[model samples]
Target: DTAVSQTPKYLVTQMGNDKSIKCEQNLGHDTMYWYKQDSKKFLKIMFSYNNKELIINETVPNRFSPKSPDKAHLNLHINSLELGDSAVYFCASSLRHTGELFFGEGSRLTVL
Candidate 1:
């Protein structure tokens, strides 16, 4: 049983399009997060939610939105995709603030 899973490990689309990535965790954790890893392998936190409550909202683009229906799931939606948006999106979860995070395999988004 996977602790966390994301759909469409690879996604390729042109600019101006919209796409959504789904993520789910079975660990029953109370916190979930979305992270973006650029081509340089720099990982940055995007959004974090705990028990369906938005806890951390980073200075991300308005075109990117994160939705958490429950503590175990968080989905990402992007509008008007751009070339700069091409990166690997990772979903993560942690039991507590000081706990080590468990990450998904990541979804690669390629915007042409």
Candidate 2:
């Protein structure tokens, strides 16, 4: 079974449209993370949800947010999306304080 799974593998919408990507992990990890891979393929940490606490990266815009209703799931929601938001969003999970991360297939969002 896949350790992590994300829905809507591909997303395409207008610039101002809001969208979300759902992610679920069955590994029973304590932490779930959201990463954004830019066109250059550079991965940047966007948010981390651990034990119901959310840690947001300072560089992440307020328009991007992570909502975790439970430990096993973390969903990314972007409001009023912009052209710059077009990228591949990956969902990951890991044990508390661990270096190893299991990533999902990733959701590609294209804004026009």
User: Highest TM-score, which number?
Assistant: 1
Clashing pairs in 2: none
Worst 10 residues of 2 by lDDT: 51-60
What are the RMSD figures for all models against the true structure?
Answer: 0.8, 1.0
Measured with C-alpha atoms, the lDDT of residue 88 in candidate 2 is 97
| Candidate 2 local lDDT, 1-112, one digit each (tens) | 8589999999999998999999999998989999999999999999998976896565888998789999999999999999999999999999978899999999999999
Off by over 4 Å in 1: none
For candidate 1, write residues 1-112 as lDDT tens digits.
9589998899999999999999999987889999999999999999999999999999999999889877888999999999999999999998866578999999999999
Let me know the TM-score candidate 1 reaches against the reference structure.
0.96
Badly placed stretches (over 4 Å) of model 2 are none
